[model samples]
Target: MATNQNFIGGFQVNRHLLIAGAALTGAGALIGLTGTVIVGAALASAGRGWVRQLDTPPSELATRKLHQARAASLAGLEAWRTGTDGSPN
Candidate 1:
């Protein structure tokens, strides 16, 4: 009778330990996922700021170069339409 009681007690203790371990594992996984999501969001925000800076055109040199390239392309296209190589006016 005493041995039977001891066996039952041991079984219950083992069950409780298993449940606690599973809960801890689930909590750790949740924490890792949360950290990953936060890091990804921070990187995405920084990338957006970098892209915005590139698009803002804050320098005269950059604007001038862009205009020059556009003009050259337009001149080339016009020459092609008129069936001649572009030459200086």
Candidate 2:
């Protein structure tokens, strides 16, 4: 099934339904039909998909790698400060 990668108000949605709703809304405007606009809005709203899981905790190796990255980042920052600003902390 096709799904939207972009978030709509912090939640994902059905891209197809959203596009259909937009088309319908544009058609409604052109034809001057309030019912069409309402239907379009309903379709667009029905497309919304609520977020369930944001992220999962890293595994052991992944956690180790994350720590390594953090250490490297700090070391690089310290080196830059010492060399450029002559400040060591």
Query: Scored by CA lDDT, what does every candidate get?
Result: 0.80, 0.74
**lDDT, candidate 2, 3-59, per-residue tens:** 766565767778889899999999878787777888998877665422222253346
- lDDT tens readout by residue for model 1, 1-89: 32232354455245566678999999999999999999999999998888677845457668998899999999989989998864666
Model 1 worst lDDT window (10 residues): 1-10
As a whole number from 0 to 100, the lDDT of residue 67 in candidate 1 is: 100
Predicted model with the maximum lDDT: 1
Clashing residue pair totals per candidate (backbone < 3 A)? 0, 0
On the 0 to 100 scale, the lDDT of residue 70 in model 1 is 100
TM-scores for the candidates: 0.48, 0.29
